[model samples]
Target: MQCRIISIGNELLIGDTVNTNASWLGNVLTEVGIDVTHIYTIGDDLATMKDILSEALSATDLIITTGGLGPTHDDITKRAVTELFDCELVLEDSVLDFIKKVFKKRNIPFSKSNYHQAEVPDCCEVLFNTHGTAPGMWFDRGSVKLAVLPGVPHEMKHLVNEKVIPKVRAINGDTEFRRSHYITTAGIGESTLSDEVVGSLVDVLPEHVSVAYLPSPQGTRIRISAYGSSDDEIDERIAPVRDHIKQKAEKYIIGEGKDLNLAKAVGDLLVEHEMLISVAESCTGGYLANAITDVPGSSRYLMGGLVAYANQVKENQLGVSTDDLNSHGAVSKPVALQMAKGVAKQLGADIGVSTTGIAGPSGGTEEKPVGTVWIGFWNQDEHFAIKAHFTNDRQINKERSGAVALEMVRRSIMGIKEMPYGFKKYPA
Candidate 1:
């Protein structure tokens, strides 16, 4: 089934409220084998609501709208829906009784405006919401289905899971079930991974399976989804495509599961290899350490970290040479390498990683410009540093540098020779 979501509120348009309802609904609907096409966010205007509702219903077989279903005057969704369906407003006695009991329990007098909450169109079926005052409405016109729900997140979610989904399944019986598998990869850009490494999924996937490349600051999550009636059937159908991707992108793929990040991947590898690691930070501050410790059970392999932001700390704490700092500066490869090796030796760790860079809107020289990062790695066997130039945004540079540093650790431990972003390691 094809579906569209309409989020109605002046708060959403004015940036007072985020449109999280649409995203939640889209994920839920897509899991049930419904293809969600568009999401429309509009203000609480009556004419606009009616026009958008009409257009959405005309284009898609299923339409879901959330918001503007309160007792206040700004809540005009019920009115718009009633006018569009040309139905008379009728008071539901059960809903009115429930609202009255709720108010009485809270020791508040129910006013005339509160009665509006119990009113529904004569032609629609009411989906009782025990969590809140607003009742969900369901209207079926021939083949098109429209459901009007409350704007509150908890109430909407409860109604969707308890009421709406059951009704939808009853209407469309024995349909295909959808499942998705995520293959995460790092140390590569999206274009390079897609165009060169994992090219042309057409021959790899079956007719029922599809692929989507979701990119973030940390890495890219390759999603492979398929539809089937049974779990075994779905898994069997997707096996060939999944294996083909793993074979092609074996070097770059970090781990499986949708919520996997670079930190978790590196931590897992560290535990497997029985190694401990430490970090010395300059430009990225504590971001590298924070990312590493974000994963649970990180203490098993994470030794410690030092944010040596100043030259004095670099020389005093991490034992970076004063001569090298004076000659090559803090952002240079020599200082980066020294910091990594020094931290590893001082902290008694099997491996050490360091990040030194110029991340800023200001502080740029012709030779060492902004976002010029030197990431260093040191182990008992080898020690080297790689140079990377990121964006001018400080936050972006920090995130990119941290991700690359973790990926570098993962690659080095796994005996991979290539560096992140294809940058050659200095002093090779």
Candidate 2:
């Protein structure tokens, strides 16, 4: 089965709103073994809406539309859909009563325009949406099934999961399902990880398996996707490719599963080792600490953090040496080392991590230029710092630095000598 998603809104076209709905629908549809062939993001124009609807009905097995289902003047999706189906708009008392009850619960006065929300095309089955004001509708036009849903993300997701997926599941019973397994890696560039590290997949991939490298600011995820009738068959198909990539990139592979991340991996290791960790950040501010604390049960391992953005804060709070700040500057190796050790002592933590850098579009010098970062680590047995060069973008630099810091902690806990990104670790 194939699906087409039509997004109707001027805000999306004008870049005011993101077209996340289409992407979400695409992923969900694909997981159910339905191929999402086309995504049409148009404005709230009646003519274009009617044309796209007509085209999708003729071209695809399923059609889902989002947006333009409001009470405003520009909300013309329902009208266009009704006109195309040659049906009259009839009021559904159940839907109207629900809307009225919701409004009364919120202590809001009901208006005439809201009455339009309860009216549905005579040719469609009302897919009741309890999450929002607009009720979703389903129409079976010959071969194609059209599910018109609200543009609100939560409402759309609710309707799809509650009402639409069951129908799709019934129609696609016992058929092949599309699924993916993700191997997440941090502190590695996409090009280097793909071209040199993972190498070619020509011989490793099975008959129906494929690999894709998804890179972001924090890390890279290698997706091993396959099609099979059951989970066991898909697992068998992807195992060879997954094992091969793991073998090739063993040290860099942080964890598996689609939602695996550096912070969660680090938190797990910290828990296993029964160690408490503290963070002292300079250029990255509280980003490193926030990432760590984002994981659940992090309180067991994460002691605390300090955002020592100012030189005085670095000295007075983290106890970075006054001499080093004057001589080597804040973004130097000595300061990084001292900051890491100082934070550990200050918080009485078993381990301390620090990031000091010039993350910039500016604030660079001849010797210490932009994107120059020094990440430090300190424990009872060992203390060292790793220097890395990153991008010109400030946000990217921050994300990469935080990721590298987490990866460094992970490697050290696992007793892996190899440094993240193969950078030389400088001893204090």
Candidate 3:
């Protein structure tokens, strides 16, 4: 089924709040085999809401709207829906009781304005909202169905999962439609990955499946979508193609589906192998360690880290030799490797990762320019380091350095001999 999401709020247009509801709804609908074709965000103007709603009903099988359901005068979604359906507004006693009980529990006085929340169109069925006072409204007009949900995220999610989806399934019934899978890869550019995949596996992909390349600063995401098939059939069709793509990009492919973070992926690998890790950070300022520790149960593998931004700290804390810093500089490969080895030995960890760079709006020279980063990793048996020259802004360079550090650590643990793209690797 094709669906369109309408987010109504002046706050969204003015940048006072983000329209996360639309993105959430789109993802949820896609998982349930529904295609979300468009998302509209508009102010709380009555005429605009009415026109958009009318237009959506004409073109889409399902229309989901969020916001403008409060008791304020600007909240006009209920009135707009009533006029569109040509139905009278009727107050629901059960909803009114629930609202009163909510206010009574909090010892707050309930006013007549709150009664507006209890009013629903005569022709619509109310979808009860257990999370909030404003219940959702469900309307059926011909073959199109419209569900009006609260703008609050938690309230909307509760209604969609508990009420709206079940209603949709009941009306449409179970049918084998389509399935989609995602393959996430990092440490490679999107254009390069696409070029590699297009040449070999594009034609071999099943007729029912289509591939899309989604690129971001983190990495490229390859989506394999299969339409008009059951779950088993879609899996059977995608299996060989997925395998071929994996083989082509095995070194670059870090994780699958929603597990895209290179740091988190490495953290999982460390936990699975029962390996411990420590880090020494310079320009990235402990960002690599922060990313690793963000995953739950990471304490099992992450030992700790030191943000040695100052030269004295690098020398005193991480044991980077003062001679190396004075001669080769802090961002040099030799210094980075020493920092990794020092931290691993100090913390007594199985693995150590370190990042040193000049991530800068300033701090560039003819020899070592800005975005010059050296990432290093050390294990008991081996040590390795790589130099990367990124040209983005300071914050982006730092983030990229952290991601690259995690990827290096992952390769080091997996016993990969060299870095991808012909980059030079320092030995232990």
* lDDT tens digits, residue span 340-368, model 3: 99899889899888899999979999898
Minimal lDDT window, size 10, model 2: 50-59
RMSD of each: 3.9, 1.6, 2.7
Better of 1 and 2 by TM-score: 2
TM-score attained by model 3 = 0.90
lDDT of 2 by residue, 179-288 (tens): 99999998678999999999998988779888899998778999988999999999999999999999999888889998889999999999998999999999898999
User: Alpha carbon lDDT of residue 48, candidate 1?
Assistant: 99
Order the candidates by lDDT, highest first — what do you get? 1, 2, 3
- Stretches of candidate 3 exceeding 4 Å from the true structure: 71-73, 96-115, 174-176
Best by TM-score: 2
Least accurate 10 contiguous residues by lDDT in model 3: 196-205
In terms of TM-score, how similar is model 2 to the real structure?
Answer: 0.96
